[model samples]
Target: MSSRPAPPSPPRPISVAELDLDAPDGNVLSLRPAPGGPAVVAGDVYALVRLRGRPAATVIGTVAAGEDPAEVLGALARERLVAAGPRGDAERLAARSRPVSAGPPPRTSVVVATRERPEQLARALDSLLVQDHPDFEIVVVDNAPRTTGTRDLVTRKYADRVRYVREDTPGLAVAHNAGLAAADGPVLAFTDDDVIADPHWLTALTAPFTADPGLGCVTGLILPARLATPAQILLESHGGFAKGFAPRLYDPAEPPADEPLFPFTAGSFGSGANMAFRTEALRKAGGFDPATGTGTPAKGGDDLYAFVAVLSAGFRLRYTAEALVWHHHRDTWQDLRNQAYGYGAGLTAYLTATLVRSPRLLPALLTRLPRGLAYARAMTAQRGEPADGGVPGEHGTHHHPWPRSLSRLERRGMLYGPIGYAKARVTARRHGRNPR
Candidate 1:
């Protein structure tokens, strides 16, 4: 045995390339080793190697060979692949490797507002049921359904786990309110039918609330489910749902300064698809506006309105990037165009409603109008340009071009928004539905 020493192990392969971590629409690049690569896992350390005249490459600390390549890359990236430095390298590695302790997580009620998409709802439920967080319940609000399909599916497949409710009212806000009424948990979370949440989503979302009793709302990050189609890429280029990769806390005492649009630009706070709120705080804000949202005349802006209300009521809101969700984008070109139109209409309507409800804020809003218009023009001009090469960056400012017709449609929607909002208000009044 001593005469014939064992042969040395083969050297592991190192992969060095620029990772486009932040594509315009929140899509990460798909990088994988050629074949027979090393295994990659979460909490693995990597060094950023910089060479002259070349993009930086990641010197992988672990070879995650023969596994799902995309999964490995994503895990490494999320764990923050950073360059080695003089400051406390050992401590960082230990912190990353430490297992998260399990404790009694707060009970949360997750609301899924769906209209006609049973297939997508099913997929969303599948992901929700398997969440690693222990204490949670699912409330599926079938909003103005033409058929009993969603109810029947939920009863048959998830009766033990999910509570199915039929909200005859036709609006995302209405459906959300219905869910709020039905939920029993102290914390209520909302997500769309088209998103698949990460296993740690609930834990990440609720942790901030526990740490700060005054925290009223928490919004998570939304990444694209896939980027195989052109429309998906374009939508992402136009600034996807991701606010930013960094965690942010908005203290009511120290509101953001120098922003042209403060509360009116509430969409920047976070998206509706992956947001949670304290039940009592949301009720105090009067729930979501029934005149807004997908099924209403305003076509959207309910989430933005809610954000503004929460902030105006003097509660803190936070954006936690770790609470992740993958949203399936509209696959067709026409759908994408319609979505763009909806966004403009929704935003304008949100501002209009704000002015109607709170006249005192008008002075500030007027001051911001010129700057807002300028920003909109800049956005229009940046359309169709190539995105910044997959480098990690801020969200909500990227501009990808839609067809000329689509752009025109969005502008038209913006012009019509105030009128539409007026009509919606009248309709809501008629129905005795005033979602403040």
Candidate 2:
């Protein structure tokens, strides 16, 4: 007879916290509760370790029932943080992380697209209000909102500081375009309504554009704001937005050797939540496709499409670790399931949109399609020992073992992507709108 398989472990709650390795006490931990969540208590803990105010690493530990959450998490964080780097290195990074080549960062407009999530929007707005960058304006794009909550919050509380624009269209890309059209700054930065930005985020993100005039786009780091639930922890374990801690430049003129897919692998550059673009460059390439994003049949690929469009336009793209945000990931298991499928759908949808937008790149994409499909298979396969040996990822993605179910969902979504994009295009045409 065949041996019986082991049952899966029961799901448990986890607490989230932040620790600064360079703090005066060097052991103080700031515990942050998830949105609408209860207070932190002793249990599994997830902490974002910072050195000199810059995110360095993340560590997961357990706080026994009777143990103090702070002390337990702080000690584990300190040990792992040391492995990240010594204090001197943190100091140097801090010293060098100034306004790059600056008289001052260029005047920029920050765009936040949302749909009826008032409380979360408030948190993000609060953080944005404190950004250290000197000249910047905030624009909130209400995307097919069902209620006036977003408008009321922006008007009642932040009437003076933020500009409100309404995009009746349902897609995230459409809302972004509405904000882009309303913005007056030379640099346009886009972020979601579910993030807490660092004080220097704008400066670090926009400064590169000034330092390198040829640069058309820049993306920054996104760390989890909370890992309070099983879904959040599991997602972060395999690198939620894991783009390494180092800075890089993606120039179309000089494609990277390691990336076999080059610009087609645009998702590798960075995520949309922490990306900025030059106003002229984005307009020239045409803003995000209206049919591709959340709330559309495409289900998401707007950001990926934009990244490739910028690169294909012969502009350089930069990825900076210095600019950072804390993203509040979806909390429930069901939400994770939806996200997995949606990600799969979005990726292929973005590829479809890319080909539709510029047919010239189809040949290059076709050449890589075979390898790309194989790579996708491996990515969605059940996670066991990592392909990169058994070493833990410095970016904190290897903490929890992954389930094959989520992988399967992503693959299913990939299969449906091209079909979804077709439906979305058909709908757009029926509505007498050109998504391009």
Q: TM-score per candidate, in order?
A: 0.76, 0.87
* Top candidate by TM-score: 2
Clashes (candidate 2): 1
Instruction: Please write out the lDDT profile of model 1 over residues 171-232, one tens digit for every residue.
Output: 88888999999999989999999988767787778767777778889998776665435567
What is the alpha-carbon lDDT of model 1 when measured against the actual structure?
A: 0.69
* Candidate 2: C-alpha lDDT: 0.80
Per-residue lDDT tens digits of candidate 2, residues 1-436? 9988665553465666665655522655465553334566777666665655665556677787788776776776665544456877645544543335656789999999999899999999998999999999999999988999999999999989999999887888888888999999999999999998878899889988887888899999887777656677677766687575667999999999999988888778999899999998898889888879898899999999999998888889999888888899998889988998998999999999999999999999999999898878877785333221111222222224676778888999999999999998887677655876
TM-score of model 1 (CA atoms): 0.76
Worst 10 residues of 2 by lDDT: 387-396
Looking at model 1, the pairs that clash are 25-236, 37-65, 38-63, 38-64, 38-65, 39-63, 39-64, 39-65, 40-64, 384-401
